[model samples]
Target: MRTPPQRGRRQGRTTSRELILGSARKLFAEHGYAATSLREIARDAGVDPAMVHHWFGGKEELFNACVELPADPAQVLGHVGELPAELRGEALLRALLTLWDSPAQPALLALLRNVTGSKAQAALIRQVLFKRMLALAMAGLPGSAAELERRGVLVASQMIGLMVARYLLRAEPLASAGHDELAALIAPVLQHYLTGPLPGTGSAVPGTGHG
Candidate 1:
């Protein structure tokens, strides 16, 4: 059998793992995710680049560790399936808004800032939203796979736009809008994405294809 990996520092008080993470967090903040490289982080931490892979699987995992969210994305999307189909859209909006309004807001804001600052960060957000969040939300919804994908994209677009306006740029009326009011206004479009008819497609009955 191959030899097991070594543990602990040879001399310094700080572990190589801690140093790597500290360097990664600092570099990611300063240069953004896409701009920072694994080698660069290793150099700054005074460790070999291989140590980064040993400590953290990859840059994405390291980023996730550094930017731990207060809430789980899958758990946050859980309410979407529980609500009545007609109400699911509103419920999703309200949930998202509540999350932004919570103490977790700072972390969420930092995530958004990082996404805006780096293409790699944006890709990670897309993966989480599409693979995890939207996939969960789309479960039991009516549509062909293609149709479901299209609807999911529309919903993501709407949500991202709302986040940019309300949270990031702090656009006027939306920024000042109450949670309930915003939900009332935004829910219909989301509902449309979930179950309503597209321009070229036949009408879809609400609550069909539910498991």
Candidate 2:
């Protein structure tokens, strides 16, 4: 009988990538984003530091890859985009609160925790929010570029502050309140951020300040 051919040893390349990502996620969750370095992740994964850079390019990219959300932010916020501009803010706030209250709460909390713990992670979070969430949410709204930027920043600040208060800190009332209740309380502020008058701009925005 002909001798059986020897199978090649498993290269384990994919395993290495998985290991890196797994380590990154754990470290990011535990130590926050800025404090967790590529070298530490590689060491935790039993891989070389170079492997991390090879796999993820840099810490920012690695953080992005590791921080996977349970839902698509674009889709979650898309309904707000679909609504009339005047109505978008409350819908957006309601939708955001509902998402955090859902099964994805843990992951959302984790991301928020990581963001609070590290400035680097905070920067990464801002980038992701602006690129993925706020950009879509702000689409087609009437404003100069500067006005739009200010509005987006204000909206994000409100949402982030709410998340920190209600979810992370578990502040009473807000923590226990239902989504609709919280949304009702917070949506008007967000509406102002979305379409309200700016500090110096004299131009009036149509469909704004109506509700």
Candidate 3:
């Protein structure tokens, strides 16, 4: 059998894992998820392909690591997409709110905090919002592709703002706000962003008139 190519200078376990992740984030961003390969990632990290599997089971898990999301987004948010379009906004929010209440909060907060100042991170964020979650939510819903994309981005913007305000920055009453209260306040705007028409001038969309 052909021996695997020699890897980079022997490195510590932590260094090896970090190298794999760094290589993964860049390649995933540049080439996208489907096009990137385990062999490619391993090669870039200067590790044996076996090391990639040892660190992260497979491509999905590897990508999850690159994103620092603790749960599979499909499992967490996928069901929300199955609901009626009108109900999706709230469902999505409630699902996320539920996850935030779990032990994953720290990792999620770190993800939100680190999204700034990194183009690769920004691209991964876009994939979650526009490519994955949005595709699932908007499936079978009516709208032009551009309009749907705009709505999806708006929805993502609100959710991100909520995460930062409530969890990361811990700003004011928002930080103290009850989950139900936040749901009541934010869900409608999310629904609107999903289906309501955008105004020609202001950012105001409906369900946002009060808070």
Q: Per-residue alpha-carbon lDDT of model 1 for 1-211, expressed as tens digits?
A: 2222465435343477778888877777666667889999999998888878876779877776765655776678886876667777887888788888989998898888877776655665665676557876777877788888988899989998999999989998999999878987888889888778786577554554657
Task: Give the Cα lDDT of each candidate.
Answer: 0.78, 0.79, 0.82
List clash counts for every candidate, in order. Answer: 0, 0, 0
Per-residue error at 64 for model 2, in Å?
5.8
Task: Name the top lDDT candidate.
Answer: 3
Better of 1 and 3 by TM-score: 3
Query: How should the candidates be ordered by lDDT, best one leading?
Result: 3, 2, 1
Q: lDDT tens string, model 3, 142-169?
A: 7778777788888888998998888888
For model 3, state the Cα shift of residue 184 in Å: 1.2
State the weakest 10-residue window (summed lDDT) of model 1: 1-10
- Range of the 10 consecutive residues with the lowest summed lDDT in candidate 3: 1-10
- Models 1 onward score TM values of 0.68, 0.68, 0.79
Error of 3 at 68 (Å): 1.8
Clashes of 1: 0
The C-alpha RMSD of each candidate to the native structure, in angstroms, is 8.4, 8.3, 4.4
